[model samples]
Target: MEIPTELSSYIRVLKLASTPSWEEFSQVAKIAGAGILLVGMIGFLIFAIMSFIPGA
Candidate 1:
């Protein structure tokens, strides 16, 4: 049995997408975590400020 060229190319892409090195994954995860934390902190600050302003 033989795979066609197009099918082989698709399989190669799938394989690459499914596997990533640990360092690459960790770096992405760290960036995502920092972004989430920053957003959360900003939201908390806004809420705190609104509470103090009394009319907002």
Candidate 2:
């Protein structure tokens, strides 16, 4: 008897879902909100400079 080449044994991975603990949730959310605010401020500063261009 001969075994097929594709029949080799392999480890299988399992997928699982999880809910974040309270500390994990709050830390992640606050960091994300802070990032958005920081980006917005930087964008506003860049736009503010457009009004002062010498050619404009």
Estimate every model's Cα lDDT from 0 to 1.
0.92, 0.76
Q: Per-residue lDDT for 1-56 in model 2, tens only?
A: 34553343321222244688999999999999999999999999888898777775
Error of 1 at 27 (Å): 0.4
Best by TM-score: 1
Taking all chains together, the TM-score of candidate 2 against the true structure is 0.64
Give the range of the ten consecutive residues with the poorest summed lDDT in model 2.
Answer: 6-15
Which candidate number maximizes lDDT? 1
lDDT of 1 by residue, 1-56 (tens): 45698899998999888666999999999999999999999999999999999789
Name the lDDT of candidate 1: 0.92
How much is the lDDT of residue 36 in candidate 1?
100
Pairs in clash, predicted candidate 1: none
lDDT of 2 at 17: 47
Per-prediction tally of clashes: 0, 0
